[model samples]
Target: MRKTALLIAAAALLGSVSAQAAEQAIHIDRQPWSFAGPFGTYDRAQLQRGYRVYKEVCSTCHSMKLVAFRNLAQPGGPGFTEAQAKTVAAEYKINDGPNDKGEMFERAGRVTDYFPSPDPNEQAARARFNGSLPPDLSVIAKARGVESGVLRGILNMFTQYQEGGPDYIYAYLTGYGKPPAGEELTPTQHWNSVFPGHKTQMPPPLTDGQVEYTDGTPATVSQYARDVSAFLMWAAEPHLEARKRIGFQVMIFLIVLAGLAYYTKKKVWADLH
Candidate 1:
């Protein structure tokens, strides 16, 4: 009986594992990003287009609370001029408080102010979305990532493939579609091929020709997804280019130091030998 029980437990555990594997069997194809690889840098034009997408669409629900307007004008970023950033900041109204009247007041946003949330508070946001709080997009590209299979993971280690987060974002953005036959979804839930459990509270956020692009870039859903994904990546790591440059410099310095140390060691041991 004990042996029989063990067998049953083993079978149950195996079944659970199989179920989990099936649930996690999502496949997301990797995308080529401008800021990928050790020596790669961000494309300024792409970043700018991405910012437009985020501002026009994603910002309606998601907040980028960690990013300040001044960041838009920083070096190694979207390449916006300080005046342009300031102008953009002034377009938004910020809530400030406690003047002589001891009451809250609304004022034009400043360069230092972070992006405002669409809802006033967490509770308000949850209530507005029927208990689903829209996530902040500040570091979303860093927070979300996809797993490569064992073989690909091993290869990624050598290739320095750290764009999984952006790839997942891009896939998720484009993964929306009609549910498969016999699949039931709640009124609020939507189908997403890349999302876990194939259901998401957020509906398809993009449509073809929804956001206009002035620089001759296509205004399609795919283009919007790619642009916004890249922008989110930049928002998550504003100093990525600088970090890569410094890392490369440090590597060269280490190589030269290693060579010098080898020669020094040989010289120091010559007489002893």
Candidate 2:
């Protein structure tokens, strides 16, 4: 009875959350992603490309302070070799403490360093973006996206359609264009179909051939958006693949244990009869 009551309470909470999400009435187009199922894994090559997109383009404005340079060389990530990661780290300059002079100095980034922000503080960031502060990319992918409705959430519990973050990112990136016939945008605002207000302060950030791709992939706007979105998703959840792997193992164990318990119960009851 206690378990049943807990289940009912959970259902009610989920229903409220789902209803709230529906009331917002936002539309986010779904996209195909490599990591979308029980056995889903990050595509190393894709992650590398996504990193390139972020480094060449997104890093100019957004900071990923939570991620370390060494993460690039870690397993289940962008798959950069340690040497490559070190080389990439060296490309950026980081501020370090005084060397006996009580003065700060700039030096090449180390693997332990976090990605630097373009501005020194929020005031500077707002000044750069016309009074709007740029959000951190550390967990933007996970931060975006809507909750699934009650019915869809239940289905997702089984099917694992957990591409909401990447899908929303892709859609938002590609969702920019001119506003409708009568719609007017403020001077600092740009039209975005997927943005909550249909207008956002940030302008469209990508274009065809905006970032040169070393991997021979076409540098289309859509491609850049998708790649960077995937990269950001990985940044937000570096252990996603491992988590899914462990989850599957646990599920299998539970199923096997349940089967064994059923058979054992039958055997004990049979002897009694």
Candidate 3:
């Protein structure tokens, strides 16, 4: 009888704990991920495809306002060439020279100029965002910690770009979901990611297999997410490759030293034993 009671108690305790865990744990549900490469590096073709998607589909509403044309051709960048980068820059006009007469006016873009930000300052930005502000995406992949190694660094670049997607950028871009079972959304309130408390104002950005891809990588929503995430990762941390190389050397040295220490300890302890 006592054992039965104890078992019942244990089961109840476990159930309670599970319920609490479910309630308290915030599931980011990091949209599903496939290994881009061994450690997370994406293929060049994937990155380019994602860029095309961004140019064709995504850039319409959100702004990549901080990057520059030259950055495209920079080391560890999109690996674009100077001519290609310049052409891309020319496609988007940035404020440049003074307009008619002596007065200044918005002019075309140059390779050196950074992308324009959506807002001039924080207050205006927040007002536009419903007391929230969209972040600058230049370093978002890296800032979000996807730039751990060569593959991860590349993959993290676009971690914010896909669905089954839990990230803010992804959520922000592909906004809209029905409200919970009973609760209702106000006309203006968007259903938020389960993490943050807001319905995304941004609308769904892609149709299934919306992006035209030549690489023959899967063209599913998940693949699109992964590819874009990788691109974003690269954007966020351009020097991660170099950093990864240095870290690898340091890790190798530390491992060798640990082995040496273990052997020396064994030798020293042998006499006592």
Candidate 4:
């Protein structure tokens, strides 16, 4: 009787675990990013469009505190000219240190200045968002990722699939919609199919025809999401291209060295035999 009772309890526990897993299962489709494989690099035009989307929409709440204006003109980035970067910087009013009068002052932003936060501080940000603080977007692409199951994780290891972050971001941006039947959300909560809990404090941030693209890209919510996600990836790893190049070179060198070592060993063994 005791053994039967233990078995029943174990079955119930397994059932509960399975139910929770089903509730939390979020399927995020992989996106075909320009910077996906070993030899891949970021697309300049796409990054530029992504920046536009962020500036016009995401920047209103999210702060990119780690990015400097000069980075926009750097190699392997959004392809802005130095003058253009300077112009972009000048549009922002940066808070400066105390002047000779020991009073805090505002000044035109310089290329060296990092992008300022949308809110002055954490308290202000929380107050603006109904007690939910907006996350800094500087490295959000690197910070957030989806879990690939055991089989998919093994495949990703072999295929060099390092795009989980961008895939999650893209899925999340496009996942907002009405809650499923029987799933109720409060006014402060929005439904996102890709979000971990299927609910988020952030509402639908993008709409159709929201940001203008001079490059003739479609002004749709999906396009905006793709662009901004790509831009965030670039921000998280500005040196990705260079890193890949160096890794490739090292692999080639190792291959050549291995071949030489094998031939030399065979020659030495042949003479001894």
lDDT of 3 by residue, 1-273 (tens): 999999999999988876765564333435433322223333566667768776766554446766777877886556789998888878765655566586657766778977666566778877876776666667675454211333444676566332222153443344445677877766546675542555555445666678778767776665565567666766665665556557668889999999999999999999994
Indicate whether candidate 1 or candidate 3 has the larger lDDT.
1
Clashes of 1: 0
TM-score of each: 0.90, 0.88, 0.64, 0.90
Worst 10 residues of 1 by lDDT: 17-26
TM-score of 1: 0.90
Q: Output the TM-score of candidate 2.
A: 0.88
lDDT of 2 by residue, 1-273 (tens): 999999999999988887777886676767878888878888888898899889888888887889999999988898999999898889998999987999999999999888888888889888888888889999998898755667777997788787888888898889999999999988999999888888888889999988888889998999988888899999999999889989999999999999999999999899994
Clash pairs detected, candidate 1: none
Alpha-carbon RMSD of each model: 5.4, 5.7, 7.2, 4.9
Give the per-residue lDDT of model 1 (tens digit) for 1-273.
Answer: 999999999999988876776665578989999899999798899999999999999998888899999999999999999999999999999999877899989999999999888888889889989899899999999998887666677999999999989999999999999999999999999999999889999989999998889999999999999999999999999999999999999999999999999999999999894
Q: What are the Cα lDDT values of the candidates?
A: 0.92, 0.88, 0.62, 0.92
Distance from true position, residue 19, model 2, in Å? 12
